[model samples]
Target: MEAVVERFLKYIKCDTKSDEETGVTPSTPGQMEFAKKLAEELKNIGMSNVSLDENGYVMAEVPSNTDKNVPVIGFIAHMDTAPDMSGKNVNPKIVENYDGNDIVLNKDQNIVLKVKDFPEIKECVGKTIITTDGTTLLGADDKAGVAEIITAVDYLIKNPSIEHGTVKIAFTPDEEIGCGADHFDVEKFNADFAYTIDGGSVGELECENFNAAGAVVSIKGRNVHPGSAKDKMINSMLIANEFIFMLPDTETPSHTEGYEGFYHITSLKGDVEETKIHYIIRDFDKQKFEERKYIMSAIVQSLNKKYGEDTVSVEIKDQYYNMKEKIQPVKHIVDTAFRAMEECEVVPKVVPIRGGTDGARLSYMGLPTPNLFTGGYNFHGRYEFIPTFAMEKAVDVILKIIELYTKA
Candidate 1:
């Protein structure tokens, strides 16, 4: 739909970038503003039971046209853009009939999205592409997914002749901070199985994701005089550095890819007296994931043994686990997504997610959820771009999944 592109452009202009430091659910007030607009748009498209929560979760339903006992399916996407890039005043440029050449994102900044850097741009061929202007993220990471889902639901509502089961849709906030499903009322939404349309590229259907956790390593030191008392003064910052070095440097996010796990140092700050190192650990394998956390705590324990017992404290909190454990029991849900892609002539790229999704947490919350593609590329960055043709295909994939479910 031409309206989908227009809607995406309007949505990105809302400046819905999430704040990691904020304790609030949506994190930014702009997210709430965008959520409200999306809810209104969902209602306008004639979705049933359209509602928004106080915490900024929007859910709507498209009732089944068929009289069969088919399972109610849900589609989900996050509302907030990544905080790593600016979402403020995102000026989207439409590249019609993508010529497969390097297009300048900003002539003033000398920013060019090169074909050499991203050869995948060649895949779009003659398709329309929406990209940022080098100043802000395009917000297509999940907004494109969101727009695709809503557009599909709208299509289903308009064409009542297309026999399908009940469809549920949800728009969530704070997914960038990894708490998208923290306040999600899954039971209230009431779908047997759901799919989060948050994948990076087209043909993506990821049921397995990283088993994740966050670690806060606090290093305490005795700061006497650095010049006069050498033995009495302990540099906490140096100890923090030492602690970071204990983990395998090769396992960092920058170094690792695919299913390989990493101990990513997210933030580091300290002085001579006190220092803190924040880390996020990720692994796809359950046993390996546990071992990674255990190894981290052991490193801290060893440091504490050398120093005082409480000198180095490691506080590790489990964020979310791989959805493979939860989705394995309901394997057919994954198959449904797979067949949906194939039926739409989109090859199924069933890969393990290197990162976590709201679906990962929702699966553990008693819903077997997987992820689908929205045709976004170079997400959460200024170079972020999306193929409009791929997004239009996403709409087909969603409806196809619903059709496959009912037929099965």
Candidate 2:
């Protein structure tokens, strides 16, 4: 458990923030650097077939010691943290024996993690908690997952007497930007089923995620001098603003939760000459997801009609779909994780993921992968933290899941 904490702290220190604007695999050079370091660590731990691919995915195998044939199961976690916040110089503050009080993260900046705002802190009372400095995000979102998987495999290597089947481990990059599965070679992974250690909170087991799409709204307007402009100048920024106001305000990320769909305007930039607006649409139901995209198209059509022809152009790309459609056919895979959690004394909390994971795309790629918890909370921001005990429990659950498979 201490080893898990040490491994997590060590991994988070590396700056591996993914960039969506990079337009390249791994998205950033830091991801490739981290991937190489992880590959070396895997080889040193005696894991066989250790390889880091060109796209910064690290894959390794823990060979079976038992004579009995057991199903191969893989554990996956992303290497890169979300690009929403800074990942550089993450100074983790460990709260030894949390007292269920507000934790002052940065005294100089007056930044704090108040229990009143995040009441979940009360649940972690008496447990060791890891938080970040006010300046940067704690990369526990999936770094904790990475450490837990490595620590579990390390434990198996040391305790070879514990009979188990072959276990596959993978660390992916650019998951934050939804490209983790884009270049993943599922055929090469050679696992019957896998689990992504990328969920939030303890005891979380998610098989369903929102069907997602990215919308890029491009607006082009003719620029004219104000003195000579009379219906000759069109403000593209104002048109973009009008387009945003057309979407339902009540159906946004802040207003919705638990299967409720939303249209999230991620970014808007430009001026009268040209403006571009970026949005992401999410819905659990496939039909509703399609309708949301259709609504966006209809709005663009109306805008273009009003502003003349070809003024508003939209490019909507489908990012990923609900994994429930893929996982439901193989129900036992989820059951195995549930049983593993219970056996490890962690209560199972089966919930729908409000966001997608690399596992969702993997499931569609013929590997029915579901998501498991990394014990992280308030991910992708400065207030992000994780319970040390929850991380330890996650490692235990991974080992128990492997043990259960061997018995089966």
For candidate 2, what is the lDDT?
0.95
Count clashing residue pairs in model 1.
0
List RMSD in Å for every model shown. Answer: 1.7, 0.9
Q: Find the candidate with the highest TM-score and give its number.
A: 2
lDDT for each residue of candidate 1 in 125-184, tens digit (9 for 90 to 100): 898899989999999978898888888888888888899998999999999889899999
Tens-place lDDT per residue, model 2, 1-408, is 799999999999999999999899989999999999999999999999999988999999999899998999999999999989999999999999999999999999999999989999899999899999878999998999999999999999999999999999999999999999999999889999999999999999999999999999999988999898897999999999999999998999999999999999989899889999999999999999999999999999999889998999999999999999999999898999999999999999999999989999999999999999999999999899999999999999999999998999
Q: Mind sharing the TM-score for model 1? A: 0.95
In each prediction, how many residue pairs overlap at the backbone (N, C-alpha, C within less than 3 A)? 0, 0
Q: Give the lowest summed-lDDT range of ten residues in model 2.
A: 222-231
How many clashes would you count in candidate 2? 0
TM-score of each: 0.95, 0.99
Candidate 1 wrong stretches, greater than 4 Å:
224-226
